[model samples]
Target chain A: MATVALKSVKKSYGDINIIQGVDLDIQDREFVVFVGPSGCGKSTLLRMIAGLEEITAGELKIDGKVVNDVPPDARGLAMVFQSYALYPHMTVANNMGFALRLAGVPKAERDAKVKDAARILQLEPLLQRKPGQLSGGQRQRVAIGRAIVRQPKVFLFDEPLSNLDAALRVQMRIEIARLHSSLAATMIYVTHDQIEAMTMADRIVVLRSGKIEQVGTPLELYHYPANVFVAGFIGSPKMNLVPVKVQSAGADGITIVLPGGGTAMIPVQSSNAAAGSAATLGVRPENVAISADGPIAGEITVVEHLGGETLVYVNVGEGPFITVKAGGDSAANVGARVRLSLKTDEANVFDTNGAAMVPKVRKPLADLEKRGH
Target chain B: MASKAQKKIGLAVLGWVVALLVFFPLIWMALAAFKTEIDAVSSPPKVIFDPTLENFNAVFERVNYGNAVFNSIVESVGATLICLIFAAPAAYAMAFFPGRKTKDLLMWMLSTKMMPAVGVLVPMYLIFRSTGMLDTRTGLVIVYTLMNLPIVVWMLYSFFREVPKEILEAARMDGARPRQQLLLLLLPLSLPGVMSTALLSIIICWNEAFWSINLTASNAAPLTQLIASFSSPEGLFWAKLSAASLLAIAPILVFGWVTQRQLVRGLTFGAVK
Candidate 1:
């Protein structure tokens, strides 16, 4: 419903900066997620956008109008906090209709709107129950229903599923995605869960230490991370980053000495990385294959047998453990010697500075411009 | 097992003994309220003496007891209401929108209560006299309100802090102004704490004797002054004094007993799971 733009937004407390200058453009109806670890300023940035926190510097615009001085209520936004924050003293219906009542909407109309929201959230039977009487998920639904009744221009969710159990988190995540599509309202969600970001976001803004690390679609980030941090943070079980010695660097590609006495030429532009310098070879668990004829050898340390996919943790020499994703029924036993084959095209090369060398052949789907930003 | 049972019985007996020890004076006073003057002052306190309501009748008839009771009720309740009106907002701001100096401010406010009231009695009395507030119910109410303000604000601040900050932030996002947040959200959430606070303030004001005796001679004198008046130069009227004291404390005793459950609950609000 509205486009939100932040131009060099910064937040600080005394000399400590919580959110460094952040520039981001969220298109109308875009489901943007601010994903980061704890103390990464994701929540603080979301609060700043919601007008709950003061932006120490820079301008924030909604619909192209700077609203740095606007109060939270005047910002036309509704938020669902992690605690649900349902009014414990009021019935579910009253909690949902609170904003409407505050806006001076007629009683009959407010009731109708609440009823409609209740039906949508499947809370019709719980309209009269207090928040204390409801289950955790039901309370979450009421929190969402409270936001829904306001019909605000933007909806902000601050780790709304962090408090729920795993199964309920997935269910609520799906419900939120459906709500976004149904309402088509611009939503800014802040969470440290990468799965939520990967599944629910139209574009994920990966932040680190108050700075924007990268901003792209889920697949774009997965296939082409901007740096080592994004590469390690975006994937499940983390990407295996092994320290490699660069043997040859050229316009064609860079050849790096892999661990356990193996060499692989990764097709990436490495103009900044010189030969004989230390660089990191980044490969996701799924991209590392366990094969008999593979060059890189290691001893299997751990085998995680998930139903659909198995994770094989291999101890390759004195370096860090490398994890390889294999079939669910993978019979690789612990203490057994195995070899890992690196998917060189899918692999990435980061110089000593941790900045990734651009891949020569970009995945068509990783194109952010084609994805409409 | 036998020793455990004996210990349990011993604990029960000890508890009863302690309870009786605490209640003995109240029981004796109640008994004296219904006795003759000679019986009240007799050696060993004449447990089997004939009971009479003559002391109560005489105490009620000799003075305007009804007017003093009315004045006590009005002054205590009026002071509590006025104190809450100021204390709630101050506590809300201190609890929710605290600054670097908020803790220091709250500590300073509580420090005022540590000073003995008599230390400033002369100054307060002179101020009241200059403002033409002597011997008036309004004057007593004002004094009681000021006397209880710091404690009231401290108690309310502690209660308000128990409310989670997230709820208030949600209210702001839901378009509630600061005033609406205080009235509609905070006051209801901390109702139990507020009730206990009002009860405590009213009890303090009702039992206060020095200020009532010093500030008012007749018109605004509360039950404390009424009880004090029983001490005359013609020797201590033990029977009439006991009767008057019993009458003056009966209402508050019953009120406290009725609200005992809520008082305990409020005091331990966040202590339990």
Candidate 2:
């Protein structure tokens, strides 16, 4: 295993900077994912690390060597493209064994490596078939198998599962997770889908406009998002941000008034801003409870039944709608008035500049159950 | 449904009629190849006559037809192979590794083909005479290679563009160097296109009458020049001329028939995709 570091890496196409001076340290055998929206530089960052794109400035190190100018093939890393990019003319065995054959490895060793990878990917039956003869999922497996035979120091996946169907994407996602653990190699995955980042990443680097926004474990990013962008991006249904103003400040917490008559105290350090400043009150959808009795009430505009959980979108007056997750068995109809309450501890507060103000907590499954929302 | 079926049948009949109309001239030419001097020139063309092999005998006896055929084979085939060798890599670079001026370069190359062949005819003749290349097969081969290179490069470039760049990049990621990429990836993927291009270049070179007529006399004369030799100031020599024309076109006709499928398939493959 080798540690990969990008020191102030910057990339530009013409005058438009795509990756603006990113510095990251990926520990050996760590699975790091770069996650961001489209037009963000996450994919560009992954390509620079793969030696596919040139770095406009700064250095990239792999295995303690400054490899800013090294070619991709000589860098001891293999990349699986977003398209899979299997050789359409070659059989599965040949496609998987191509790198070794190019390296001038003996026929016996190359064949053995290919066969071992085939067994791992369950591609033994497809050894003689071309990519055109295989389904999309099988072709992706062969693409992964091609990388495995190389035994590289790092594996790069550029949205490898984006082309597959939803069912197959989930299946392949699990397969990749298992493969990463079994091989114990450093993997850097780039994807726009936050679900993949949250589910598969050891640590996620969220990027925005070529700058690194936050780098943390999946749970860390989920709980202690560095800004409003990460706060909304990391969670499903996104965090609800209602405009609020700091009415008063005390040593223990800051008192904030909602749009209507309700007021709440959120624990925070307000040294930067005085009392009576505008801020966004951030709370996750899961933290908002649809109760029979609470401070605020609104008519349900939409109800999504997902079998295990139901998301209710409530159009509270003047402000943006709030989403609350309730039991799937809950029979809350659309246009029905429902009361909503925010769980105080689960609530988070952000300043006018979109920076979070509370300490994040990682409650175990047991701890989450004990609180009983 | 009935109307559609009737339209299909009507179109099929029209197609057959057009096809037969196209074949009529070649059929009459082959017939004239077997005719005597008088029957060949008959104004109301003799549909049925006692055919003789005298014209064929005269063709073989009067000129070294076998040597002419061999010259045609060597010149056309040699020129085609050379064109492919130069054009394939140039086309690959133009298609895949293009720069800002690639399209302009391709257009410039194609424009050379549009230049009137006669504009340089006198200069070329004088240069060949001075170089002692007047009656040499190499002289003819050089002319044909130049004539075919632009079209050959254009055809190969178009075919290369149809191949997805992802395949080549995938090959590179598989650690394939330049040579391996050409041999193992591009050549295999674009075989049909390259095959059709080779066929077209060979056909054009084989039928090149201008250079063949002016550049060579007896020693290096190709079939086209051999056919041209049948004309004299004294008379039209229709019977002999017909026979030579038939002989000259037979080889290309057979070649065109053999590769017809591949040529049509390659040409149409781009339209649908």
Q: Which 10-residue span in candidate 1 chain B carries the lowest summed lDDT? A: B262-271
RMSD (CA, Å), candidate 1 to true, equals 2.0
In terms of DockQ, the best-performing candidate is 1
Q: How many Å off is the CA of A109 in candidate 1?
A: 1.7
True contacts kept of 1: 0.87
Q: Residue A95 of candidate 2: its Cα lDDT?
A: 93
Local distance difference test values of all predictions, in order: 0.92, 0.87
RMSD list, candidates in order: 2.0, 3.6
**Candidate 1 residue runs with Cα over 4 Å from true position:** A366-373, B1-14, B268-273
Candidate 2 residue-wise lDDT, B165-237, digit = tens: 7667766666777778777888888898999989888899999999889889999999999999988777777
Model 2, residue A233: distance off in Å is 1.8
